[model samples]
Target: MTPPTGRPLPFPSGASPLPIPSPPALPPHPPLPPGAGGPGARGPGGAGSTGPAPGWRGLPARLARRLNRVPLRARLAALTAAAVALAVAACAVAAWFIVRDQLNERLDESLATYDISPRQLQNQLTACSGGVEVPSPPSPVTVQIVTAEGDSCVGANMIPVRVTDSDLTVAAEGPRAELGPYTPEPGEFRQGTSADGTETMRVLVRPLGGGGALLIAQSTASMEAALDNLVRLLALAAGAGAGVAAVLGLLVARGALAPVHRLTGAIEYLTRTGDLRTRVPVEGDDEVARLSRSFNAMTTALDASRARERDLVADAGHELRTPLTSLRANVDLLLRSERTGRTLPTEQRVRLLDQVKEQLVEMSTLVGDLLELSRPEGERHSTPVKVVPLHSTVEQAVRRARLRGSGITIDTDLGHWYVRSDPAMLERAVLNLLDNAVKFSPPGGRVEVRLRHGELTVRDHGIGIDPADAPHVFERFWRSPSARGLPGSGLGLSIVAQVVRDAGGTVALAPADDGGGGTVATVRLPGWATGGDADAATATGATGVSGAPGLPRATGVPGVLGVPGVPGGERDRRVPDGPVTPIRAVTPARPPQPARRPGPADGRGEGTGDGAAEEPPRS
Candidate 1:
């Protein structure tokens, strides 16, 4: 009875929904083209109306695009030519107007001041009254006489100019009394046509002394001819000038862009050949020369980077080969015993396994060092740098060193110092320095660690480094001949150097200044005494660490030992007379043990191989 719940109740139980009348369908419209609604589209009147014309509106834009396709030198030449042409055309037009004005002024002056004798005028009037032809003047001037009653007469062989009301007025007034030798009589000058309507003339109307007016007229045909000739000459000159300008512009553009052309060629050569040795020749002190010099410097740097890359690869291969070979040999020995049904001694088996583990650890350390060196210099500090307490970082490193070298004694004398740097990186650098000293120290030998102002020194009483080897100790993978037999990857000092350099500090190794038979490593960093403003210092992002009370700040000068702002002289190196609170000596974890020498199980270390006898110290 419910009509299946969702069937619209059977259209309201057979009453049926009233059929909704369908609207009539209209005609369909054709699709419009792309951009039909844009500026070029039809107006509201649809197909019958028009929108703005695109042709003239887009002309300048279209022309600009075409011009852009032209080469730079050609564009420069064209612009120069256009500028010169415009200038020449303007000058020509101005000169033509000036000359026309000058000619017209001369003609008007001569006509206005023309002399006429009274006797000649009387004879002309008598001839005109008797209806006889008046004699013409010697020149081409047309002379006529008009009476106050509007009667006129013309000379024989002369053109009669049309008379107007102004002439009649002049005839009735007689001659003007204001006439002077330098000034023409009062009259009006006008352009008029001959009575026969065949000639154009310049007419001047002047009243005669007795009773009528005289008209003087001249033809303008010769003056027009002269002006036309001048136009032709000026146009020719302008055309010639424009042509010459275009040629000179092309030459100038070619010469000025010569350096740019050479630079482009060098860049192309380098790109095609993958060579960084290509250098552009620089000449003059212009912008182009500076660009060339910059290009040369870039190539030099790239070449050096490539050289360093090659050396690192070769060194890494050499370092990895020894550990891998030893591991393979040991594995094969174990596999051989098992396959041959031979039982190996337990002690020997355990010892070989321990050796394998140690070698793996050594290989792991070498790989980590390689990865660190391979990272981009900019990405060395993965975390934000901050103002770090230098003394605390040194204490942490010394603790680590004591743990590593239990048989050695490390004495620390640290002072309050703060430096802006990545805290972890700075600590790692200090630890490496301590490790170097610890590695070289003999059993029960004391290692003195001291920090004052912003300088840190670590001294060890061991066989001193050879002066010849000191220069190369910080080079990657360089192990001294004497230290080659010890266990090390030879990258410790290299990493220390990189970190210290990035922190805007300096590190160096030299024989003990006290004449002790050991090496002393000194690190100098810049910083101010006291806490100062931590936030301000962090914002400044200075590389050097701060100094202690009563001491001048380290100058932060790379490889420079002198402290800046010290009165009179460089700060003395002695521990300033302050309470020297020496850290209690750390007890040895085990009885003092002699240093281990390299053996077959030790492999040859990361940077030392059987063939690396001449290598420098890993420290």
Candidate 2:
């Protein structure tokens, strides 16, 4: 059954109830007005108003910003003066309070010790009752008597003290007998003004014998005058102390910041003049001195970098002049020929065109070398490094060298060495080395390349480099007098050195150990014997020269492969199309071997071999 509200009633116990549907969902409330529930909106407690922070809350921040505008030295001095003034003020206040308490205690003791004869008290009492004036007391104190009904009597010519309720209470109490000579009757000590209110006084009230109280007061004008003078003196002293402290603080700040001032001046000089040679003078080994040293070091490095840049520009210009001049001259000749309408002979024309082409190629090679060298050392290694098989890179370089120097023979024995480097850059470095060796070799001379134990050496049986020129061979655009006529920009070895260094290696050129009049360029790179793919390839000896097509095989001998005067041509012995083995460490000299005659299969008379090995011409 439904209730009066039109809702269903509960089901009976132990019976299942029918399902009731949910009420329909209500629509969302409308968006709030512009300022409602926003920054300045009033919440229930009115807490969310967008107003400036209270003065006390933001006082420190405002003060700090204002203080920051002041010079550091002035601020420090002012702080010192303020601190001194506060301390002086504190000490002066303490001294004043102590002196005031001591003076008040003495005055209270004198009032307590004061006593009057009974006759004089009765005379004053009779004078009050009879309405007659009483004579003034002998001391500089004011005396009065008060009854329980708050009536008071004062001495003639003396100001009467205003009686408080405490004095009336004392009067209502019956007077007690004196305790002892040293201990006077108890009384309340308080500060009060005279009845006319013109003078401040210290008042003491004590009970009289007959249901009344006696009051004694002393003027505090002298004590107060002394205290005022002390205050003036303390104020003057504090001012003087603050002035001294400010001066001392300023002097200290100036002395401490002297080095900083010098450093700033040096920096300004450098900035204004654009000179990197300026250095700050260093004295002690303090932090400022260390900063000066660091500044000097920075300038020194900048100067060195500037010098290097200047040298590079000068050298580049010098190197570019030769090829540019030749190009200009060749173009001028072609233009003249075209303008004259004179057709040159085919052979001459072809030779001129070929020379022009060669010059262009040389110029392109030089530019590429410059670009490669211009890249920053860090930028060169920014890419992910790959583990390259050093032997394979060397094999590729050898094949290219053979094609370039077809007349010269190149024999190689490369071991399975793997190094982490940019594969293309590594190949370029190796190619440059091989090309250098090929270029310096005689027309029929052999270039021996050996790689083992992470060291690669390329030896050419040509004019050897002099000991003096050895140091400069790797320098940019530096060529020896003997090799200056050769076709090169003199940046080959420099590029090789830079690349090898980037790969954590070293390259050097020296006279061959055999003293056979040749130069051997040795490159020692740090790498592993086998890694990743090279590990598998090395397992089966797949990295040998025989597995690499287009690469000539190396003769197994340690020194120059061919015998000096063998019947069979040395060319056949230098490079045989057979399986090659790893070369042993190169020694200083080769052991003599028995000379043998040419066999039928040797093809000595059949002219199959190139030619016999001739001794290298001595310098």
Residue-level lDDT of model 2, residues 1-619, one tens digit each, is: 1111122212112222222211222346898886676556775434575455565577888999999999877888899889999999999999999999999989999888776655555555445444343565466787786666666665555667877778778877746533223344434888987776678999988665455667888888888998999999999999999999999989988887788888999999999998998998899999999999999999999998898788878867876788789888988888899999997888988888987887777666667777877988557656445557889988987887788788999998988877656777677777777777777666788999988767788888766655555566776667665555455667777777776666655666766657586767777654556565344433433333323221112222121122223666331133343444323212223233222232333211110010001111111
List the lowest-lDDT window of 10 residues for candidate 2.
603-612
TM-score (C-alpha) between model 1 and the true structure: 0.69
Give lDDT tens digits, candidate 1, residues 55-158: 66888889999999998789888888889989999998998999988877777787877766555554554444443434554677877766555556655566
For model 1, the run of ten residues with the poorest summed lDDT = 1-10
Backbone clashes in model 2, listed as residue pairs: none
TM match of model 2 to true structure? 0.63
Taking all chains together, each candidate's TM-score versus the true structure is 0.69, 0.63
Task: Report the Cα lDDT for residue 437, model 1.
Answer: 80
